[model samples]
Target: MSVSIIKCNSYRECRAGIDKALSLIGGIEKFVHPGDKVVIKPNLVSKKRPDSAVTTNERFVHEVIKITEAAGGVVTIAESPGGPYSAVLLKSLYRTCGMERAAEGTAAALNYDTGFTEVSYHTGHTLKSMPIIDPVLEADVIINLPKLKTHAMTSYTGAVKNLFGVIPGTHKAELHFRLNDRAAFCSMLVDLCERVKPTLNIMDAIIGMEGDGPTSGMDRHIGLVLASASPYELDLAASAVIGYAPNEVPTVREAIKRGYSPKDAAKLDVMGESIEKVRIPDFVKPESHFNLLKLIDLPPALNALVVEKLASRPKIEYDKCVSCGECARCCPPEAISMASGRPVIDKSKCIRCFCCQELCPKSAVRIKRSLLNRFMVNFLK
Candidate 1:
């Protein structure tokens, strides 16, 4: 597998940055042809501004659309918001990221409601058919433009995680509730990626999120754009730069096991800047009930039951929580309820999918880790 990287300085240079990155791997002409219906799926998880580093840089998306259109392809920008799947959010993202102006100027349309289609994947597991955004399914070529950000649940969100946007907002919560366990959830993510099978994957690493990420986190500049045909390979490369081992990341490991790509960096060819130069500081992984599963030795059946029973939904820090109800609204199982002007978690029904933590607008929800849990984690590490 080949992955290309270009050292970009700022958003103003995005067009040149994309040109340099793509040229290193073959050009837009190679991946997209004339009259092709190209869908550019950027990370528009929320309505956050570009500097927040929570979503893909609008400049990057604009550059991709510009290149595709110049190469004689019809381009359309689309995404399904994380929770509450609202056109309001989509419009807000476009406006805040300056994508609205870019789209209009480039003659590309912004689609919030493209409808849905059923796509089947032979996971050989329990899940058979999955619903995905119809525009993604029907597109002749999908240029996956994802933001390079750290995720509390997945360690890092790169090319592979971006595919999650393909699942319609209405069904995302259901999937989270169904695949509650980390391993199971990772399997579901891989299944979705397999069905979508993006033609090309590009990561906007010019500015990346760290600390409690994907949605809420601190913005740090990394100044790079990465591209590859294989999402798994791109993720592996990005994870290493963030000081994470490929095997330790559940989703990348699961993808490798499913015959996607080799998890080891030595097995793949990385083009462009040296990994040493692009590496960033390590990020903290979110707390999960599964961490306890590693400490105790129990039967698989009993272990599963224990995890289900002990898993906790996110707890709100009232002082920090704005009571925006973003956490309550995004709760996959609807386990979070606003009772007396504060968010409460229904532990019995919580799935520990971390969607609440991932989508919390205020970054108010944090995994309530006990002292024992902290000690165990330190000892294990």
Candidate 2:
């Protein structure tokens, strides 16, 4: 497999830059054929604008639609952004993420289909089958557009992680609460990628979030766009671009364990600029990540104490919290509640999925890490 990395300074130049990236990988026509139904799935995880680096850039989305149209492929932009899953909610999401404006004057249509078709995952890693939105299942080709960002749970959010958007509404939260462990949860993510099998992946790294990301974080200038046919290899390559050891991401680690990606990523024929040329030297990692725990040799009581010590728990800052109830609505296990004017987290019930942190628009939730936990995370990395 081959991956293309190009320098894309801004959205104004995204089209030419995307074209160049596609050209390096044999162009868009190679994937989109005439009369094919193309579904472009992008990261619309929240209601934030593109400049916040919380969602995929609309300019990039528009360019992909244009290319698919040029290839005579019928295009639809589909994604179940965070909120109620319905035609009404999707329509609102389309406007929030600029999907409606991006598809305007283009043959691309914005999807508001609330219907879903269940398919067997067969990966058997975590799920047997999942209900996917109709647009993805009906598409002849799927074009994945993902933003490069840090994820508190998975460590990195890139090609493989973005495909999780296909799971449709509340099922996403249910899985997060069930397989709360990063390692176990990533098995589901890998399975989703295998089942979805996108025809192509285009990464939006022109502006990426770092620190406490995928939702709340600082936007930094990454100034690049990437394309790959294999999401696994694309993630492997993206990890390098972000200056992360591929193993730092649970999805990448899981892929390596399952031989989805080889340990020697040097085997890939990387086109365009070298990773070193565009790599972020000071790129930040997620503020909190899962800890490696082994309790086989320890006493049960001691193991429980150690587990509590090593894990980073979410804490709501009384001063910063807005008491919006968004956290309560998204807490997969229903662990958070609004008390008076503050959000109180049930530490015992908290799954550490960081859904509360990710959904907190006010950035009030902080990942509270103990000193020992901090040292352990660094050592493990």
Candidate 3:
């Protein structure tokens, strides 16, 4: 397993960077055959524009579409973003995320199909069976186009995490409710990757999000494009480039435990620019993801208790909130409810999945850690 990395300073340099990154591994022809049904799964996590670093850059996606189509592969851009997966929502998301413009001159078609098929995966540790989007289920080749970003719930979001989009619409909230434990949720992600089995993985890291992300965060320029056939290995390298220990991200740690990827990303075969050359020494991580309990060797029961009390919870910013009820609608455990045009949380039922923070359109949700957790974080540092 090898990962190819190429320096890409801007979207304008996307085509060359993508081409070279693919070439380093093998080539576009290696994965795409003539008359192949290619599904380009870009990370349109929400309706945010590409410049926000919330989704895959459209220029980067467009170049992949062009290259795939040139190789005699039929291309379709597909993604089940953060809300109800309806034709209307899909149309708005595509237009906002620049998918419409990206597919303007190319033969790539934007997917509006909300249909899904349940596939059985007995091998999955956490997920035995799940509904996958139709386009992905019917594809001959799945080109994973993911953006490198920090996630409040998962810490790092990359190739493997991108596959979470395969689960259609509100079922994602159900899964989140079922797998409230971070380890279980991450293990499910690995299982999803195994089930999807992407043909190739390409990551856009020219501008990546830091601090609270996958949506709300500041953009930091990293200027690199990365690719790998193994989604696990691709995430291993991409997460490390942004200053995370391989084990720091739960998904990468799960992959390591499963023997899907090396325990250390440094052990992987990396081409083009070395990790040290592109590594950001001070990339900000999500505060909510930091747990000091890992350092203490408490009994299982006590550990779980402390982690629950100390874990970060979502707080609604009343000033920033538009009272849109988005947070209440997306809450996995139904812990949130709209009262007098404002959201009220039932702390007893809260699961800390941060779905409200993730799917909130107004960016009104914030991660709030307990006072003891804050002290522990600073003390540990």
Candidate 4:
């Protein structure tokens, strides 16, 4: 339950910096044993280059692979992205980040489909068992290499959120539709994390996205690399460094309640530098209300009605939208249509999963709140 925070000033020194950070928390050998099949899960959500800050840096992935090799473990890079999960996109992302050449020269194999093996989870609720992607379930160890970035849906996307890549691309939209509420989504994220428990968690924060992130956000220089054995602990440290509270992030709060180490920062022995040393300026929370139920308690049906009416997808600026159709393609429940010039969201059918907001390439879509909604949010804060 220890987290290590390091102030990494440049990607040029990422390999050495990350090595030092991992050394503080029992080192790579402690996690990846000899002859183990280590899966390096970097944030390859899209084909965007490293400079875009949309995906984990190639150099960071290479560094982790180097460490795994040094530990006598076989390394393989893998991920499942939304909207037509293709090996081509994954390979392209790696090449953009300068990983393709390294993979070939290092003789590291890349597993795309590794196909799928169905594993069941007994939830003890309406869902008796759910099938998860196979590569994650079969790997001897997983080194979660996630980029530090803001998420329009869950507030911040860190280690735990990055594990969502294991859910497989085709099934992700369905899961979003099923777990519509923020609390429910948080629960599902923790569930997935528990199922595919990574041996190590690493955050690539040398350059991170903010404002409207995960996909379409501006990059800011935040020179640091974070490592932890516990994903929850890593997320807690990440939230703090980003000027957010553990409770403010639904996934972190839920992980803590589920007996994960989100709080108890004192129990976490930070390694390279104090969090205050690498702390970034306060990041603005996306324009959305978090604690909706706290404002008023309504019956289940009434609450559903109110939330549905209140939550509407803000209009997409066609000029700004690059006709990528990513929003239309990823909309859960198939509520977005691009039959017109650009994508048009059907509010009545929309489930408000925020998949479009997270995947939009142009940063055209945002959560628009009316004057009353803004007033209520301000008053509540």
Candidate 5:
């Protein structure tokens, strides 16, 4: 399968760009059939404005809904946000992210269903099962719409990483706590891609997030809309465009190891814009992407010392905190707690998932790297 990369400088041209990209890959009609229950899975991670680059562009979603309608498919926008999952919270997030506005006049509707189904995803990996959001499981066609961004935890968040949202609510915490190691979590992610392979994967890279993202990052004008049948291939292109070695991303790395993706991406049938023409040389990656430890097979004693000595932990800023208890409520390891209207993070118990940081609306959760980690980070760079 080929990856289609089209230039869309702004959300104003999102429709045209999307149409051209889809047409090159046999059109939306090729996948979605009449009367199909289509699920549009966008990266609605939080209640942030589209310009913040925390979520997918609403205009793009509207345009896709229009295309799906023309193809005679019933489209429903579905995403389980990072914090507690509820109709009220989901509705608020939808409203803030302009998704509710997209759903207002369009045939597409926002998913309010909060139920989950325990899916047995036997991809021959450590993770054999996951609790998939009900709407995703019930849909006949899943159109993954991911936003290109840098993740503090995974280093890259693209098409494959985006599917992690399918594990609804606090159940995501279970995965994070259980598979605490980055490589293990990433293997589970790759296995997930194998299990719930979306019919199509489209990306919103018009304005991507960089420097500690998935949330709380600076906006980057990438000016591109991408599409592919394989999310893995699409992410390969995305990672390259943003100056990341494809293997640097856990999902891509694991996919390559599993023989699910080509190691030499030059083999991909690339169409539309050339990767050379759109590639950014100095795109900002997360500051604490010091995951080289995972590649080295250190002894148990050394591993413990390395993790304890160099690992970055979350620190709550009292002045910036709203005392909403979001960090405590969403922490995968139950590491944070609210005390006297302030959030206290237990570094000993913290698994460093950054779920608290990703979910913190105030951007109050900051990454506090050890002195050794800071020095080593600069040394490595």
Candidate 6:
């Protein structure tokens, strides 16, 4: 399998970069045929603007839509962002993320249907059956448009993690509650990617997030656009660009273990700029993931004990908190509750999924690592 890694410095260069990337991988026509129902899934994780690099760049997605439409495919932009999925939320997200402007003069339509249907994936290692968004279920072809970012829970967010948006509203939290183990959660992500199997994978890396992300992070210009037929390979290449080894990302590690991707990214057929040329060696990873727990080869039970102390936990920034109760409402394990207009977290019940941190609108939730863990991490480095 081949992945196209075109160097695109700005959103204005998206059309050309995306077109070239598509051509390098045998063109949009290879996946999109006339009259096909195409669903373009972009990561609108929150109500963040495109410049923040929290969500997929609208200009980048616009180019994908135009190319697919030019090939006579009916294009629709669909996404189930974190929190309760509804038409109102979707509308607000579309407007805030600049998707409305992207589709201003185009034939592409935005999906407002919050309805979902049950899908059975017998081959899934962690999940057997689940609900998927209606637009994705009805599509003849799925085109994944994901934003490259570091994640608090999953380490890296790209091709495979992006498909988590298809599971409808709060069902994502349900899965997080069920499979609290990091490996199992990531395995479920691989299963979701395998089930949906997007015909094309495109990533927005022109300006991506670093440090604690998917939502709260600093925007770093990586100046690259990536595309691939294989979601696993796409993630493998994208994660490597940002200084992550394949095994560092849970989803990529799972993919490699499942034989879906090459363990060594150097073995893949990479077109356009070399990974070495564009690689950011100093990319800041999520501080929440800086601990050395994963590197220690302890028994399962002991490992969990050590991780409980070392792993990062969510902390509410009371000064910045607006008492919105959003964190309480979205917590997977019901570990958070709003008491007297302030949300309090039940650490005993907390599963460390970071849904509160991820879905918090005010960025009031922060990852807090213990003093001992911090010292160990720094000393190891």
Q: Clash totals for all models, in order?
A: 0, 0, 0, 0, 0, 0
Error of 6 at 305 (Å): 1.2
What lDDT tens digits, residue by residue, belong to model 2 across residues 1-381?
A: 799999989999999889999999999989999999999999998777666789999989998899889999999988886546888778777787788888988988888888888888665688888878889999999999999988888888999888888888877898888898677899889988888899999999899888888887789888989999989888888878888776667888788888988774566578998887777768887768644543437887887687777888888987887778888998998889776656788888998998888878788888888899888676765
Instruction: Please provide the root mean square deviation of candidate 5 (C-alpha atoms, Å).
Output: 1.7
Q: Compare the candidates by lDDT and give the number of the best one.
A: 3
Query: In candidate 6, what are the lDDT values of residues 1-381, reduced to their tens digit?
Result: 899999989999889999999999999999999999999999999898878889999898888899999999998999998788999999999999999988877999999989999999998898899899999999999999999999999988999999999999889989999999898999999999989999999999999999889798789999999999999999999999998888788898899999998987898899999888889999989878764545568887787787777879999999999998889888888988887779999899999898888888888889998998898788866
- Per-residue lDDT of model 3, residues 128-225, tens digit only: 99999999999999999999999999999999999999999999999999999888999999999999999999999989899899788889998999
TM-score of each: 0.91, 0.94, 0.98, 0.91, 0.95, 0.98
Q: List the residue pairs that clash in candidate 1.
A: none
lDDT of each: 0.78, 0.85, 0.91, 0.78, 0.87, 0.90
Of the candidates numbered 3 and 6, which has the greater TM-score value?
A: 3
What is the Cα-based TM-score of model 5? 0.95
- How far out, in Å, is residue 162 in model 2? 0.9
How many collisions between residues are there in candidate 1?
Answer: 0
Question: How high is the lDDT of residue 351 in model 6?
Answer: 91
How many residue pairs clash in model 3? 0
Ten contiguous residues minimizing lDDT sum, candidate 3: 287-296
Give the best candidate by TM-score: 3
Against the true structure, candidate 2 reaches a TM-score of: 0.94
The residue-by-residue lDDT of candidate 5 on 5-61, one tens digit each, is 999999998999999989988899998999999999999888898778899999988
lDDT, model 6: 0.90
For model 5, the superposed segments whose C-alpha errors exceed 4 Å read: 291-300
Query: What is residue 156's positional error in candidate 1, in angstroms?
Result: 1.6
Model 1, C-alpha of 347: deviation from truth (Å): 2.5
10 residues in a row with least lDDT, candidate 2: 287-296
